[model samples]
Target: MISDGVSVEALTQWQEATVGSLLSQALNRWPDRAAIRWPTPTGLKTLTWKQVWDSAASGAAQLRADDPTPIAIFAPNSEGWYLSLWAVALSGRPLVPINPALTEREVRAILMDSGASIVLAARDYRGRNLLEAVARLNIVDIQHLWDVDDWISATQSATGAIGAVAPQSTFVIQYTSGTTGTPKGVMLAHRACVNAASTLIATLEPGDDETCCSPSALHHVGALIAHALALARIGATYVMMNEFSAQGFVEAAASSRATILAGVPTMYSRVLDDPSFADVKLPDVRVLMLGGASIPVTLVSRLESHFGARVAVMYGQSEAPVITATRLDDPAWMKAHTVGRALPHREIQILGVATRSPADVGQIGEICVRTPVRMVGYLNLPDATSKAIDDEGWLHTGDLGALDVEGRLYFHGRLREMIVRGGENIYAREVEEVIESHPRVAEVAVVGLPDSDWGEIVAAAVVPRTGATVSADELSAWVERHLARYKRPTSWRFVDELPMTASGKPKKFAIVEWFGAIDGN
Candidate 1:
């Protein structure tokens, strides 16, 4: 076993078993430990490992009797939601969890692509009746396991060979947002899931006695399996939060007695904004993780002082999601400036965009990754999949970054979002990072807008810090001091707030409506 912390020999014992096998073992091991939690108007709801397993087993038995294939979950984050994931795994069937906030059209696209035989629609997820809604769509065969209780006992009589399902079998089909064109279903095999989980668990080094909390979505690997499942690998008690709220998080962490509560940059901002957390007792909390997007140095400094020596910064994506993460002991210079080195069994190479060769120290390039945990390409799109995953199996992550000699990577931005100002390429994330560091900026988003003179001009949207003066010129000058001339934003707008998805990444396309309404141009 590699000595990181969560060394369970999962790779050797159940390496060939399905995800359900892992879930089953985890549940059996900690039948009394709390596994999931959700929010209520008045308080929070929680589930123990045994209760979750029993519920999932019932769901799986129902699913197997119905179709013995993929089951799609069109819902939000909750205890039932997580139970559905385990249930699908237990049945040795693929599970599809769609974002609840997506439009009808977007939702339809996912349904069509997955070819799901059943959709698990229960009531009270963010107050939507997903069951009736999908039946209204009348797209594919859909069924509510809740609606059929008899199937559970009937199928359990024949729950044979399921626990032994091979790990290399397709475990999940998560669709990437179709921003570039159409959404592609990423098929992750059982082996891939196990490897990813093992690597992440080893990296975190959670103690067996640790209690963990994840407030992010489970559909996203960064939160789903990365932090939550990783902690669970070593028998750490895990508490789930339905949605992110500053007061709710602090209360839940204290309530569940969680030692590690994972958060994104936005989560940290909310806690800082929460008045109740200022004087609240947070003794159980130890590690505060920041990921999904880069953390501002100013925010880091403020959070470090406020949270007291446990804030860890990380940078990740859907592809190779656990690329680099900071350790609590990292020095200020490394912690503030870079995404830490790769987790165990993972390797990264920053190749110059033009050369496709290893970039010189501090030179930016397209970040490519080779990990045993990598997904089994985008489903059914062979040509598109071929372009992304090469013959050598390296996933071309389409994200740009610079590698320091110490092997830490500083993220630049998405390859498609790069701005070309009079033929000079500029990474918007690099510029936005600088803008976000300004004292008066609460949040910021940088994008390239059409400009007749320069082809594509760097435009930014800034959310001013609580009742503070923030001018376009001042922001532009701040970026200029930190970035090259062409990398600075040329045009900008200051707003009361910026639009974001539940995951806290700025929805760049959605901002058009808000920005257009504000400027009337």
Candidate 2:
């Protein structure tokens, strides 16, 4: 019914499917067509739909030979990573994705919690030897650890047939970005993922020949569902990046003749600032899709002018992907100011904190979503799961927003103290716990400071022990050992004492104002 010749009936059929079944359909429909394309030092590498399906089938066969426990992939985005992802799905094992930027301790915690028996990882990424780093964790539960190259090589001879998987079975155990100071594994069913991807594809309506360049990390749900699965559903070409760099993205987009590009606002800002961005001609690009963080109005205008593409803004979380998004035909003001209206078959309500009911139009409150794509629940945390999803089947997102009279949703901010730095969520308590562990620190409070480039940057306000002296460099080093690079505080302030309320809680608003004054904001 929309463009690109995808029928509403086809989307309805796909909503009740699994990833394996979809991949099988793609192989049959576009066997020789390009499925994935990525950059190499020499040039670009391309994989056809048949080649990807064969590789994944082989890998899935090998997985069937081992214990049927959850499998974790700890690597950057690459061809092998996609193959492994499909392999896990075909093998009927839940995939647990870990961010490659995480430290050894952080990786260990996920592996232990998920009880993943197998790990498919890159031998080295950036400067870290991931194999050695994971080995250093010394986790006894990890039974099989394969380097991606070796795993691909060993599975080449497999001839096992792919089996059908249940749509309601868990496909991915996606961990949140630690919005609550502790990372909770969100169990997404195959039906949820398939339906989410189908909805996104219907909304975007790209042609079968459309080529998309994506720089988002594969671990995040935004990229996994929106880019990876959605593109597959439509049988479009997907151009992936091992990691995101402004220059790298510009080069890939131009070289691939990309028709669609996707990334966070920070990535786009970096691209706009890059010198090569102006020189590169992305004339084929028709859509600039953005999500994962707030979109600055100026940045949206700049992106439109520079790329000559329609900018679409989306708002969602890992628990429920693609709750609301601006359509391709939306007016510029609507795209700039709101995240658009809820998609078809989805419902959104603004819960009034005071009235304990739906808020009036233009009244800001918590955003609640009821969708078929919502995650089944948090893994092994029934209490937390119940707290997030109410008895009415509505998932209460901790984000604050309001609905316009026209039914468009306007995003205000977060209800909790979660910092989104370059599209990565960092909880205030998570960072504060690390800083407070220092012997010379009495107490510490972490807050998000607004920035033009990064949506927000982590800032720490510390109180030193009596007669003790501590430097910012010392605290930074301490945090680096325990957390990821993005979670570390970039700005530090030492205060004699933190402002407190009568309830014996630190007044976070006062600290934010203090930082604003010091920065002359």
Go through the candidates in order and give the clash count of each.
2, 0
Error of 2 at 109 (Å): 1.2
lDDT (0 to 1) per candidate: 0.70, 0.82
For candidate 2, write residues 332-351 as lDDT tens digits.
Answer: 76886789888766899999
- CA error at residue 421 for candidate 2, angstroms: 23
Task: Residues 487-510, candidate 1: write the lDDT tens digits.
Answer: 787768877766665545777765
| TM-score of each model, in listed order | 0.90, 0.80
Error of 2 at 351 (Å): 0.6
Candidate 2 at 337: error in angstroms?
A: 1.3
Q: Against the true structure, candidate 1 has what lDDT?
A: 0.70
* Poorly placed runs, candidate 2 (over 4 Å): 1-5, 12-14, 418-521
The top-ranked prediction according to TM-score is 1
